[model samples]
Target: MTFSIVARDGDAFGVAVASRFLAVGSVVPNARIGVGAVATQAFARVSLRHELLDALAGGESVETALEQALAADPLREQRQVGLVGCHGARSSTGADCMDWAGGLAGESGDVAYAIQGNILTGPEVVRAMEEAWLTSAGQPLPRRLLGALLAGDAAGGDRRGRQSAALYAVCPGAGYDECGVLADLRVDDHPQAARELARLVELSELYFGGPEDVESLRGDLAEEVQELLDHVGVQGDSVAEALTAWAGEVNLETRLTPAGIDRRVLEELRRTAGR
Candidate 1:
């Protein structure tokens, strides 16, 4: 049906997907934090997703982890799977299909990945996947994973045609944080879903505010900080509340400067203005 791997190397998370049919997103995406890997495919094993995450979170190796899991299922051969950890160790499995099938597993400097697909020759798909993975450079893990999938697609992917795609990555931080977003994008149907997903991911990087956003924190009338306070409607005895609200709007670093606006200062200004 579809094949791909979700993996992490330390703080970086990655996802890769490809298929002959349209809309491969649901069957071909996988990811975990402290865990190893997860594989969801035709006759997709939904439980395996969480189970793999549980095993990884418990500090199980990709090998021992998947072993105990597959042991519980007799139809393991008909399934495809792969897992890698921050240490670069890995494991993979593929089964005989009515049609052609193929896959590969490998390690690389604290990072590893597995790739598999059906309705295609095994070596050709794996070869294209490996080559694409090696040639990609300086990009994030998501990009690298997508590159691998694209290579397989070019080499004759699922044999059904193309449709949907997806991407996911995890890192530390809350949802509102710029650096947050462990699992990112999903494009369920389209001719170029992978490319579209990559574009959105890049656009997100552009608009997401971070420490550098301090440069945009200036107030109007050369008193942008004051504008922030006024916008928040803090005056007189309410100056403390206003300053608190303003601090939330502008960077605390710029607001707390020696020339920074603070609660006491806002109160003084409020009294002078007789507001």
Candidate 2:
């Protein structure tokens, strides 16, 4: 009924999920900063998301946290879970889950990941996710998770067809306004839910994300920026100031640098000016 990946990359912990269920994101994924991530599906006990986080925050290993969370549940045999903590990764496929239900957990260098699914087309879906996760090591945490998620979908995601998909991740200072949330996006119902979720992830990067590198405003680039600012009716005494105003108006100020702008900002300026 669902397929998901839970992972810890550097200081970030996140989950990407797609399912035939409505609003799978609402019940399948949860994480706490400095704790870990959990995804409970296939007769999901939504409370397990927080229960697993609580156990992990209390210093339990991923395995222990999962075990403790599922210990008392009477329908545990019908529930599936995946977890990735600071220490390691663990996954559970319930005995009573539908055929082709299973999971994989492993480490790629310092990063840990768990991939699981139920009622999938085949085991190849999970395998594709694993391969993508391993090969996408150099990407940002959000992109890495999204890569694996899209791979799984391309490999044939939920057997019942895609209805919802989500990508969520968190790290200190990664979110807008200094919050820990990095990316929290979901396509609640869509024919191409996974791909739609990926599109949302890209938009999130442009809006909520900051720049990786910045270049000083000078010469032609500066002139172009000022022109675009004027075209957009954003007034300022200088190109940088006008750019700042424009970026702020569009909620992209985070990508601005001191006396400079990131490539994303430049591209956005071009877009607003319709060039």
Candidate 3:
């Protein structure tokens, strides 16, 4: 009833999952910056997420952590899990899991990934995901992960159909307010959960994403940008103050830069002011 991948891209770790079950995100995905990521499903042992992450943080290999996690569980044959860490990637599909269940793991350079699914349409589903992930080199981690999920969906996702989907990624001190999370977006219940999840990811990028490559504001440019903020009803005594207020209003405080405003933020201010 579920499919998931846990992967490492550079110093970041990410997980993407889809399932016929409701609220799969709450149970399937977990990640920590500088540690690793894990997905537990198909009679998921939710506790394994914490245990596996703990093991990885303590310098255990992905394979070792997985073995320990399974050894500690009496109902191992009913649980499915995939893990990726600095050491590598590993996954397991319990024998007692529903038909059409399996997992795969692979690594290239510093990037490692694992794909697993149970009650899926066929092995082709996971294979397509692996192919997509491998082919998406040089792209952002979230986009590559989402591409894999979409490929699984195209190959025939959860034979039971879609009800929920989630995307999670983490980097050191990359979360909101510098909390160490990168992206955590979910479509808890959607007919086309993967597609909806993609949309939510875009919105998340706008509000929570980091600054992009664009020109910064200063001196005269800063004053002109401030004039736009004032035109948009953002009140402040100075340009920096006004832009900061506007950024807070639009939930884009994270994208503001001390050197000047982020290009995306400036564009948004223009758009909102025009409206």
Candidate 4:
């Protein structure tokens, strides 16, 4: 009924999942910065999501943690799970899981990934996801993870149909005010949940994205930019102050720097002022 990928990218770890069930995000995915990520489905042993991450945090290898977690569950044969962390990647597909249920794990360079699904169209679903993840080098973790999910959906995910999807990612101090959550997006219910999830990921990048390289505001450029900000109703005694206030209003404080405003922010201010 669901497909997912748990992966480690550089110092970050994340999970992306999709399902024919409503609000799959409420149960299927979990991640922690510097520790690991997990996706528990099939029968959906949600608690195992935390247990697996805790085990990884305790320095257990992916295989050992999965073995112990399965050992503790008398009904292990009905559950499915995927795990990836500092140690590596692993997955489990219980014998009692529905037909077409299975999983795969692989690593390339610094990235390790595990893909799993139950009641899926076939092994092709997992294979396509694996291929996509392996080939998405240099892309951001969320985009890479979401690309894999989209590939699986294209290969025929969840034999039933799409109802919900989610993307959860984390890197050290990546969240708001350095809180740790890099991205946590969910399309709780949508006819095209995977596509909707991709859209949300794009929005997350715009709002929470880091700065890009571009020339800084200085001299006459700074004054002209400040005039634009004032024209947009963003008031301040100075250009930097006005830009900072506008950044806060648009939830883009992360893009500000002592050198100058982000090029993207400056462009946005100009665009809005022109409008």
Against the reference, the lDDT scores of all candidates come to 0.59, 0.90, 0.89, 0.90
RMSD of 3: 2.1
Q: Which model is ahead, 1 or 4, in terms of lDDT?
A: 4
Worst 10-residue lDDT window for candidate 3 reads 212-221
- Candidate 2 stretches greater than 4 Å from native: none
Q: Every model's Cα RMSD, please?
A: 8.7, 1.0, 2.1, 1.7
Clashing residue pairs for model 4: none
Q: Compose the digit string of candidate 4's lDDT tens values, residues 131-237.
A: 99989989989999999999999999999999999999999978677778889999999999999999999888877877776457788888888788878788888
Q: What local lDDT does model 4 show for residue 156? A: 98
Q: Can you tell me which runs of candidate 3 are displaced by over 4 Å?
A: 218-227
Q: Of the candidates numbered 1 and 4, which has the greater TM-score value?
A: 4
Which of 2 and 3 is the better model by TM-score? Answer: 2
Q: lDDT score, residue 42, model 4?
A: 91
Per-model TM values vs. the true structure: 0.68, 0.97, 0.91, 0.93
Write out the backbone clash pairs for model 3: none
Candidate No. with top TM-score: 2
Where is model 4 poorest over a 10-residue stretch in terms of lDDT?
Answer: 208-217
Predict model 3's lDDT versus the native. 0.89
TM-score of 4: 0.93
In each prediction, how many residue pairs overlap at the backbone (N, C-alpha, C within less than 3 A)? 11, 0, 0, 0
